[model samples]
Target: MFGKKSRYYGLATVRNTDRQGRIVQAVKLRRLPAAGGVETVVTDGSQLDVMSEHQYRDGARFWHIADANSELEAGELVETTGRVINVPKR
Candidate 1:
């Protein structure tokens, strides 16, 4: 038997950077939660835009918004909220 639980969503940042610069760089999108962060396509490995942006002041991680959806306008606020699903062994 198996059991599952519900989890809430919080703000996290997606860390990525533009494909420019001499040594490459990164930047923060600021105030994006875990779910929103996922939507964020952080190019950087850590998505820590270290070269282009700064870290959170209150110890919060970087975050990014989800990609554009036809249902959504040019800009809309969205988030990721759900329990962390654990993958079972095959």
Candidate 2:
């Protein structure tokens, strides 16, 4: 099982723990497609290592999913759930 794991796999936040140790926060994923198109990210930390302002922004924008793939010709706030990595266990 260990050998089958993705190299980019690592701990990811699945909730927003509060100061009191309560899940008051939202979840977060670990790995992301690297800038060079390689799906890579550090896999030794409990949290996703530092991400630049732009890098973080791009991640947010890419979290889009949709139905049967199709070409776009206009603009709209469509709901989507495209390729999404499962939030790793704590």
CA lDDT of every candidate: 0.26, 0.29
Give a tens-digit lDDT track for model 2, residues 2-59.
Answer: 1336432443436566888876633253334422222223243312222222334432
Q: How close is candidate 1 to the true structure, as a TM-score?
A: 0.16
TM-score of each: 0.16, 0.20
TM-score of 2: 0.20
Provide the RMSD of all predictions against the true structure, rounded to 1 decimal.
18.1, 16.8
Report residue 62 deviation for candidate 2 (angstroms): 9.0
Highest lDDT, which number?
2
In terms of lDDT, the poorest run of 10 residues in model 2 is: 65-74
- lDDT of each residue in 17-85, candidate 1, tens digit only: 457734532332343323321223233232222312342332122121111222132122222223121
Give me the runs in candidate 1 sitting further than 4 Å from their true place.
1-10, 22-90
